[model samples]
Target chain A: MTEVTLSNVVKRYGKQQAVHGIDLDIQDGEFLVLVGPSGCGKSTTLRMIAGLEDISDGEISIGNRVVNDLPPRERNISMVFQNYALYPHMTVRENLGFTLQIAKQPEAQITRAVNEAAGILGLDELMDRKPAELSGGQRQRVAMGRAIVRQPDVFLFDEPLSNLDAKLRTQMRVEIKKLHQRVGNTIIYVTHDQVEAMTLADRIVLMRDGHIVQVGTPLELFNTPVNTFAATFIGSPPMNLADGVVSDAGTIVLRDSLTIPVPKSARAHVKPGQKVQLGFRADNLMPVGHAVEEKGELVDLELTVALTEPLGTETLLFADLAGLEVQAKMLNPRPVQPGEKLAFHLMLDKTHVFDAASGVALRG
Target chain B: MRRRIPEWFVLLLPAFIVIAAVVLIPLIFSLYSSFTPYKLTRPSTLWRWIGTANYEKILTDVKFWSAFGRTILFLTIALNVELLLGLLIALMVNKVTWGQRTLRTILMFPMMFSPILVGFQFKFIFNDNIGLVNNALQSLGVSNAALPWLVDGNLAMFSIIFAEVWMSTSVFAILILAGLFAIPQDPLEAAKVDGCTPWQTFRHITLPFLMPFIFIAMTIRSLDVARAYDIVQIMTGGGPAGRTELLWTLMSRTGYVDARMGLANAMGYVSILLSIAFTVYFFKKLSAARAELGMGG
Candidate 1:
C-alpha cells in the first residue's frame, strides 16, 4: 500500500482551469472519497492520478516517490473505470491474467493468480465465458477482478458502481469496502453521491468548482462545516437555511418577521441589526406537541405540510415553514396531513449560524 | 373452402416476381444452355441436346485448363499482395494525427477511378516502344535495348496482375479502415495500462478484432477479382496468344467471338463454384473470429 500526495496540483484545459491548484495528503491505506457536483474536476483529478490526464502544474508523489513524469503502468497503479472497460475479446480468465501474461509471468503462476482472484470475485463459474455472455453485475465483478489481480500499490475506482441497479449498487458498495479491507490497499474513489462518499471514505474531500471546499472525516464535516456549501452538501434532506437578522429585542428575527432568542454561544459572532442565516439539520427539528416547549428556543410557526414520507422507522414531513419549504424528521408517527398547518420546536443549541453575505459558518 | 390471401404476401409478391424474372429465370436458362448446343445466332439449335460433350471438351482442353489454373494463381497472388499493402496503408493512416481526413479521402481516390481507366494508364506506362517507360529508359541510357513489357508471356501476365492489384488495393484499405474506426478506445487504453508494447497491442488486440472486416473485404474482392474483365480487355484483350487470358476473357471469346454459347455457359457454371468456395471459406473464418472475441456464437 502507498500514500498519495498532491502538492499544488493544477490541471488546465487551454485557458479554462479544470482543476485549480489543490493540495491533499492521503495517508497510507486510507480510503479517501472525493465528492463533488458535476464540473467539479473530481474525475479529472482521479485521471491525473491514474496518468490518464496530464498535470498542468505542481507534483504528485506516490509512496514518497515523485511520479509526475511517469506513465500509468510505470506508476504501478490499477484503475477501475465507471464503464468497466473489460477486454471484450477475452474470457474472464484471460482478462484477469492479462497483466501477468504481459509481465512474462509463468503460465502456472498466471493460472493460479487468476483462479484465486476469480474465486474471490465469485466468478469461478464464468472463467471461460466472454464479457458479452455475462450480466451487468458480472461485468462489474470482472472489472474488479482485473484490478485486484494486478496487486498494484493503489486502486483507483472512478464511479464503478454508478452503472448498477439501485439494489446492486448497495450490494457492490459493501463488496468494494470488504475488498479494500481484505487487500488493505489505498483506494481513492470518486462519486457524486454524498451517502457513498460519507459511508465509504475514511476521509472525505468535498470539492466544488474545481477547488477543495473542505477536507475532513465524515463526522467532522457533518458536525462542523466550514461554509454553507459544505453544510448543505454532506447530508440527505440537506440543511435548512433561513434568512434572519439579529434584533434590538435581544433575539434573531426570521424572514417571516417572527423573533426567537439567539443562542448565548453565538453572541460574540453576531451584532445587533446584522443580517444572518440560521441553519439546522432536519433531525434537530422536533414536532411541537412531542417536545417540551420551555426547554429550548421554541418557535410556533404555521407550517403547511406539503407531503409526508413514512419510512417505517420514522416519518419525514415536507412542509412550508414561514413561506420557505423545509423537511423535519419525526420519530413518533403523526397524522400530519398535506396542506395543513403544524407546529415545531427548533433546537437553537443544535443550530448553525452563517454570515449572510460571505456564506461562512460563524464560530460559536 | 374460401381462401383469403395474406396482405404480407401481396407486398412481397412484387419483389418475388421481379427477382424471378431478373435472376432465377436467367440462371435456369443458363443452366439449360450448358447442356445444349445453343448459339446466340442459331435459335433452333437450342432444342438440340448434347450430353456431356461441352463439359468433356472443356475438361480435356489443355489451354482451357491452363487458363483456369492461371486465373487461380493470379487471384491468390493479387489478393494477398493487395491485403498486405492495404493493411500497411491503414496502419500508417491510423497513426496520422494531422490531416487524417484528407489522407483518407486521397487514399480513396484510386477506388473512384474505373478499373478500365487504370488498365489504360498502366498499359501506356508499360508499353515497349514509343511508350513512356521505353522512352524514359532510353533517355536515361540505363538500357541500350528496349524491354518487351507486354509481348512476353511472363511480362504480360505480370503487367495485367500489377494493374489489377493497383486498382483494388484501396478497396481493402477503405473497408479495413472502417473496421479500425469502429474498434472501441477502451481496449487500447487497457492494453497500454497492462504494459503491452505497441506491436503487442496491435497483434493481440487490434488485428484479431480486424480479421472479420478483412475477410469480408476478401470475399467481396474475390468475387470481383474472379470476374475481372474490363481492365484485362482494355489492356490486352486477352491477346498476344492468350498469355494473360483469365476466365472472363476466355469465356467472352468462346461465347460472343467464337459463337460457342454452350461452352461459355459451361465455363460460367464452373467459375461460380470457385466464387462460392471462397465466399464460404471467408464466412467461416469470420464466425470463428467473432466467437474467439466473445462477441457472439
Candidate 2:
C-alpha cells in the first residue's frame, strides 16, 4: 500500500471554482473519510483522487509517483461508485474477470482470481448470474467484489452505501469495514453522513463550502472542535448554541435570566460585557439533584415538550427553550406528553464559549 | 368500485380507426390480391382467383428465380456494408467533443437526399466518358482504357450497392448513436477501473449494449432493402442483359411496364416471404439482446 498526498490541489469547472486549494496527506492503508454537506466538493475531491477528474492546480501523488497526468487505469486505484456500476450485460464472473481479461492475463489465472474474489465475498454461487438478477445487497457485494478482485494500491468509495436502505446500509457498512481489515488497502471514502464518517474513518476530514475545516479522529473532533461548525456538525443531537452576554462576574447570561460559568481558558480571549455564545451537547444538560447542585450554576429552563421519541431504553426529548428548539436524550423511558413544560438544569462547566462575531470556540 | 373503461382507450380510438382504414385494410387487401390475378389497369381482374397458376409459373421460371436470388444477394451485401460504415461513422462521431451536433446534422445530409437523387448523382459520376470519376482517372493517366462501370455485372451491382449504402447508412448511424447515448456511463468507468483496455471495453460492454439498436435498424432496413426501388430504377433499371435485376425491378417490369399483374402479384407474394424471414430473425435477435441487458418485456 502507498500513501496518497495532494499538494495544493484545486478543481475548476469552467469559470466556477468547485474545490479551492486543498492539501492533505493520507497515510498508507489508512481509512480516511471526507465528510461534508451537499455541494461541499467532497465527491469532487474523491473523483480527482480516483483520476476521474483532472486537478486544475497543484499535484497529486499516489504511491510516491506523481499521478497528476495519469489516467484512472494507470493510477492503480479502483473506485466503487454510489450506483454500484456493474455491467448490465456481463455476468458476475465476467464482471470480476473483465480487468484481468483486458490485461491479457491467461484464462486459468482469470478464473482463479475471479473464484477467489467470489469466495471471499460469498458471490461464488451468483457468478453465472447477471447484475439484474441480484438484489441490492448482493449487487453491492458484487460491486465490492469487483473492486477487491483488482487488488489495487488504493480503493476509492464515493458514497457506495448511499443507495441501500437503512438496515442494508448498516449491514454493508460493517461489511465494508471488515473488507478493509481483510484487504489492508488504503481507502478514501467520501460521504455526507457524519455517522458513517465517525464510525468508518481513521481520520475524518471535515469540509464546508469546498474548504477543509478540521481533520482529526472522531473523538478529537467531537471534544476539540475548532469552531462552532465542527462542534455542531459532529454530535447526534447537535450541540446547541445560545446568544449570551458575558456578565461583569465573568459568567455568561442567557436570555431566560440563566447564568453559566465560563471556563478560565476563555476568560483571557473574552471579557465582561462582550457578546458570547454558550454551547453544550445534549448529554451534558441533565435534571438537577440536590447533592450535585453545589458544583455549577443551577439555572432552570421551563421548556415545552414538543415531541417525544422512544428508542428502547432511552427517550429523546425535543423541546423549545427560550424560543430555540433543542433535543435531549434521556436514558429513562419517561412519558413526556407534547405541550408539557419541564424544568431542566444546564451544566455550566460542560458548556463551551464562542466569540459571537467569529464563531471560534473559546478553549479551556 | 365499478371498473370504468380506461380513458386511454377513448384517446386511442381515432388512431385505431385511422390505422384500420389506412394500414390494415390495404395490407389485408394486398394479401388477398396476392392469390388473385390483380391488374391495376383492369380492376375486374382483381376478383379472378387464378389460384396457384401464377405462383407455379414464378416458381418454375429461371428468370424469376435468378432475379430472386440476386435480390437476396444485393440486400445481404448492401445491408452489411451500410451497417459497418454506419458503425464506424457513429464511433467517430461519438469521439468528437466539439461540433458534434453540426457533424451529426451534416452526416444526415446524404440520407436527406432522396434515393433517386443519389442514384442519379452516382450514375453521372460513373459515366464512361465525361463523368467526374472517369475524367479524374483519365487526367491522372491512371488508365488509358475507359471502364464500363455500369455494364459489367459485378461493376453494375457494385455501383448500385454503393449508391444504396451511401443513401441509407445514416439510418443505422443515427439509431446506433441514440443507443450509444442511452448506455450508462458507470459501466465504462467501472471497466476502466477494472483495468480494461479501450478495445476490451468497447467489445465487451459497448457493443453488446448497442446490439438491440443495431438489430432494430437491421430489421427495418431489411424490409426496406427487399422492396428496393428508386436508386436501382434510376441507375440501371435492371438492364445490361438483366445483370442487376432485383426482385422489385423484375416485379415492377412485370406488373407496371409489361402489365402482367397476375405473375407480378405472385412475385410480390414471394418477395414478402423474404421480408418476413428477415424481420423475424432480427426481431428474435432484438429480444435476445434485451433479455441479455435485463430489460425483459
Candidate 3:
C-alpha cells in the first residue's frame, strides 16, 4: 500500500503558477479525489504526483520514498488519461502487456499479467480488438486494464470519465470503485464533476484558484463546508446563500425588512453590525410536511413559489424570500403553480453564517 | 438524323480527345514500334513488323540485364537510405520549438531546386580535382591525394546515387514530417505513463503511426527513381565502361544516340514492369499499415 504525500508542491508554467505549493497527505488505500472547475490546478497537482509533470518546488513522497527526481516509469505509477490514451495500433492484449514487455519480463509472465488484468476488467472477449474498434466505454476499460497490468504502487486518474456519455460515466464510475476495492491500491482520481467526487472519494480535496479550499469526507464537506466556495462547490443545487447582516437584537437582518435568529453554531462568532451571509441547503428549508428532519430550530415563512421542478419522488420548489430565490424541497407530491403561497420551515441549527466580506464560515 | 449526343459526353469529349492525341496515341505508337525495326532516321521501317525481335535481343543482352539489376539495387539502397535520413531529420526538426516554421521551410530547400539544376550542382561538387568534397578532405588533411569521385567503377555509382539521394530525400522528410504532426499526442503521453523509455516509445508508438506515410513516400519515389535519367546522365553519363548505367540511361542511349527507337521502346515497356511491381508492393504495405491503425477502407 502506497500513500502519496505532497508537501509545498508547486507548478509553474513560465511566469504563471498553476499549482501554488499545496500540501496534502493521502493515506494508504484511501480513494482521494481532487476536484475543481477548469483551470483550478487539480489535474496539474495529480500529474506532478504521477511524475507526468515536473514539480517546481517541494517534495512528493510515495510510500515514504521521495520521488521528486524520478521519471514516471521509475516512480512505479500508472495513470489513466482523460482521452483514454490507449495505443491505437495495438490490440487490447498488446496494450495491456506493453509495460511488461518494455520491462523485458518473460513471455509467460507477461501473458499471465495480461490475462489477469483482462479478467479483472471483463475484457477477455476484447483481447483481439484494437482500441479504435471499441466504443468509448470499452476503450476506457481498456485504458484502465492497461493501467492494471502494470500493478504500480499508485493509480492516478485524470478526469477519466469526462469523455464518456452520462449513462456510461455512471457505469464506469462504479467499475472504477469496484476495481479499487479489488486491487486495494492507493488511487487519486481527479474530476470536475462533484457527483463523481462525492460518490467515489473516501475524502475529497476541493480546490479553487490553485488553493485547497477544504479536504474532508464527502459527508463532512457536504454537511460543514469551510467556506462559501466549498459550500457551493461540493453539493448539488448548491447551498442557498442570502446576503444579510447581524443586527443589534442578535438576529440576522436580511433585505426587505426580514430578520431571523442567528444559527446556533455561528451565534458566538457573530457580532452586532457584522455583515454576514446566511446559508441553508434545500433539504433544510422544506415545507412543513415535506421537511427531511424537524429536529432543528424552525422559523416559518410565507413565501410565493416562483417555480416548481418535479423530480418524481421529490419536487424542488423555488420561492422568493426577501427578493432572493431560495430552493426548498417537497417530499410529498404537489401540483403547485408559480406565485402560490407555501409555509416553509427554515432550520436555524442546520443553517450556516459566513462573513460577507471574506466568505469564510463563522463557526462558534 | 444522328441522335443528339449527351451534353455531359460532349463536354468531356475535348479532354478525352486531348488524352488520346497526347497520351494514348503515342503509347500505342510506341508499343507498335517496339514490335518493329523502327530506327529514328528510318521512319518508313515503322510499318515493318519484326515481331518480338527487339524484345528477344534485349532479353538475351547481358548489358540490358546488368542495367536492370543496377536500377533495382539503386532503388533499394536509395529508398532505404533516404527514408532513414528523412526520419532522422524530421524527428530532429519536430523537436525544435522556436522558429519551427522557418526550419521546415528551410528543410524543403532541396525539393525546390529543379532536377536538372540539382544534377549540375552535384556534377560540379563531385568533380575529381576541384570538387568541394576532395578540396574539403584535402584541407582537413584526411587525404593527401585527389580522390576520383566520378571516374572509378564504384565511385561513379556512388556519385550518381549520392546526387539522386540529395535531390529526393526531402520528399520523404516532408511527408514523414506531416505524419509526425498529424499523430495524436495522447499515445506518446500514455506510453510514457505506461513506463516506456524514450526508445521504446518511439519503437512501439511513434514508428507505427508513421508507416503509412513511409509507404506512400516509397510508392511515389519508386516511379521517380525508375526514371532516374537526368542526374545519372549529368554526373557520370552512366560512364567509364557503363559502371552506373541504370535502365533510363541505357534506354535513352539505345533510343536516341544509336537511333534504335524500337529497341529502346522495348526496354521502356520492360522497365515499366519494375515500376508497377514496386508500386503494388508499397500500396499493399500502405493499406496494411492503415488497417493496423484502424483506418481501413
- Among these predictions, the greatest lDDT belongs to 3
Q: On a 0 to 1 TM-score scale, where does candidate 3 land against the true structure?
A: 0.97
lDDT string, candidate 1, A153-175, tens digits = 99899988888899999989999
Model 1, B1-297: lDDT tens digits are: 979899999999999999999999999998898999889889888889997788998889887888788888888999999999999999889889899999999998888998889989988988997668788998999987877888888888888888888888988899889989988877776776676778878987899889888988999998999888988898888877988888999999999998889889998988788889888988898888888877674
Better of 2 and 3 by lDDT: 3
Name the candidate that leads on DockQ. Answer: 3
Model 2: docking quality category: medium
What's the C-alpha lDDT at position A83 in model 1? 83
lDDT of each: 0.87, 0.87, 0.92
Task: List, residue by residue over B1-297, the lDDT tens digit for candidate 2.
Answer: 999889999899999999999999987877777778777888898889877878887889988889989989999999999999999999999999999999999988987898888989999988887778778998899988888888788898998998899889999999999999999998888887777678877998899999999999999999999999888899899977999999999999998987777678778888889999999999999999999998884
DockQ result, candidate 2: 0.68
Q: Model 3 Cα displacement at A212 (Å)?
A: 1.1
Q: Against the hidden reference, what TM-scores do the models get?
A: 0.92, 0.92, 0.97
Q: Write the per-residue lDDT of candidate 3 for residues B146-250, one digit (tens) a residue.
A: 889889978888888898888888889999999999999888988888888999889999999999999999999999998899888888889878999999999
lDDT tens readout by residue for model 2, A245-272: 9998877887777666776567777889
Residue A134 of model 1 has an lDDT of 91
